[model samples]
Target: MTKLSLKSKVDFIFIIIIGIFAILVYSTRNQSQLARDSRMIVHHTSSINTVLEKILSSTIDLETGSRGYTITGNENYLEVYNQGHKNLEIWLDSLRAMNELNRGQVLKLDTLERLIESKKQISALTIKTRKESGMDAAAAITKAGRGKEIMDSIRKSVAAYQNQSVKLLSANLNQSEVHVKSRNWNFTLFAICTFAILFFAYLQIRKNTERLILEKIIQTNLMTELTVQNQQLNDFANITIHDLRSPAGNITSLVATMEQDSTLEEYKVIFSMLRKVAQNLNESLNQLIEVLHLKKNKIIQQELLVFQDCYSRTIESLQGEILKSNALIKADFSQINSIMYSKIYLESIFQNLISNALKYRDPNRRPEITIHTEITKQTILLHVSDNGLGIDMSKNGSKLFGMKQIFHNHPEAKGIGLFIVKTQIENMKGRISVQS
Candidate 1:
């Protein structure tokens, strides 16, 4: 469950839903086709019945018109005969067309068509006999009963066709009833299955949400505890640095006083060394205090500071060292001369890097430290390159920014400068790197 991501789970649920919906669509389409077929059957049956009745009615009209003309020799009876003949042809054609699908009905319709034709021929013969011979002659043809036989046959055929159509209609209605029931059942089953899947998905989502909320609460509590512990550690570190500063100052003062009182030439060298050690200790302590102060204020106010101003201050502070080492320092801030940063951090960074370069200068050549700024699409870059007794990266790269990690054998190699610089940069959400 933990291995499955939220997107994967959601996709799986949707796949199931889509599969079910596709099945429902296919099933409903088949049911709809069944319903459509039932309706077509019902319509065909009704049309066949109507055409059979009309054929019977038209035959009756022909028989009545021929009989009337045989008795009275009326021309109106001939008109009825002509109209009935036209109606019979039309009704027969319609039946033939409609019954094409049913072979049995086609056979019945063929027999009915022959019977109607025969009935029309007899009526035509009687009418011709009445007009050409006389009423007596027409009566003689009708008296033989051939026309009545054909009429009875046609009636029987029509009744049989209508009965078959009624049966077909009944069967289709029953089948349609079954299809409707099946469709209802399918819909109910589909509804139940869809609900089940949706309910299961809902439960899974609720469970995942609850678990996430619990994890978030646990994480928040841990963070709160960590913040409190970090604050306490900072307080302890500040107190320790404050206490240590006074002793380091006393040592510096004592060394300075002892140096002034020295009388012998040999003692002068000892005093000078002693004074250097005390001064170095005081500086280290001061640097440590500065680092502690940086920790105390995690978020410091930033102001726009000119790169040239910070560089000048760092150079002025290290004037003595620069002159002693015969260092060549140059800077180019043409691309970006100013930045938004903590003044203390920027000045300390310059002071540390420049001083280290001077301190670790190659004795064979004059120290050359080049500082420049560059602007890229995303960020402003500051480069500080130096020609010094370079570090062996493979040996001391990992420990370069570690406190008290000395790589050089110089007397002033406290190893805290790089560490402090790294800390300051990181606090400002910036990073520093070195290459040799």
Candidate 2:
């Protein structure tokens, strides 16, 4: 059995209690109604029995009077006969009234009415015989037993009708009891199913809530770890840049002093080589500093910038290096007139691309490079290409824009230039693509 959560368990218990209470209430109400019905049935049956008894008593009285007149041959016995006849009429009316209340008793009433009429006819004949002849003749007529035989037949019919009424009453009572029992069972089963559904729903809600809480906790921990790692990387970059600055400065100063003393030719060549190495190192240091600045924060507070003016300034900065390499330079700015960007960032991008073209020139070929812009509905497209030592697409394609990944064996290649370019583009919510 899987363990249920606190809320789920509470809901389960609550639902079960509610179900039990509902069943008790419903069963009590149903049983009360069933009892009321049973009482009504019993009341009707008792009334029918009372009517039946009255009719039977009247029949017995008529029979007795008929026999009495035959035996006594008196007018007083006729009085008894008349009284029984009147009572029979009254009982029949009462039977009819009772049957209106309980229609099942109608058959018994009909049989009783027929029997009473036959008895009345037989009593009238007895009276006639007593008045015409003597008591002996009436007695002989009674003893002949035709009236008794008719009475016997009437009694049998009444008994059959009573038996049928009794059977019908018993069947109705049994059916009513069974129906009440079946309703009780169905109500109990429905309550159980409803409680089960509520309990399961509560369990699912609690499980999902718990899972969400755990996921949030894990995400918080991961974010905290990443923040600490970023801080450590920033600290290391600062320390390394501070340590390298002094040595690079001392080397540049010593090479400058040696180049100024030009008495020895071989020493001058050695000093020039040392000066070039120092210049390269200084460039590498400057690149590192720029990258660190970008990593700290690329967004700068700046005034509106004109792209044409910025491009002209960047080209002027690289004019000497471009002239030395004899590189062909083409510029196009007709489509995009200007954009809002930091002038330093734009200058850095232009200087890096132009310097790389000059530094990575194909030894056997003339250098050529192109820079241009195209505007669309949503964005401005910038293209920078070179026919110098173009990138070897197969060997360095994937890592071309990665940080600190050098492609050609150029002395001035620091590999951070294109990486910075890509980062700057993305920081402005722009995109960059390279092709060879």
Q: What is the TM-score of each candidate against the true structure?
A: 0.44, 0.38
lDDT tens readout by residue for model 1, 1-436: 3687878888998899899889988998999898889867766775676566567657766875787687777788788688889989898888888878889989998898899889989999999999999988988888887987897788788778877877886687677767766766666666667667766877877644454345446645655655564444433333333223332333333333432224444333433343343333334445444544455475466889999988875665454466556789999999999999977678767877887798789999989999999989868789999999999999999999886688889975666778767877887899999999
What lDDT does each candidate get? 0.71, 0.61
Candidate 2 structure quality by residue, lDDT tens digits, 185-205: 544455455445545654665
- Kindly report which residue pairs in candidate 1 clash with one another: none
- Which candidate has the highest TM-score of all? 1
Q: After best superposition, candidate 2 residue 404: deviation in angstroms?
A: 1.3
Error of 2 at 84 (Å): 99
* Deviation of model 2 at 423, angstroms: 0.5
lDDT of 2 at 232: 38
Error of 1 at 67 (Å): 1.2
Each model's backbone clash number = 0, 0
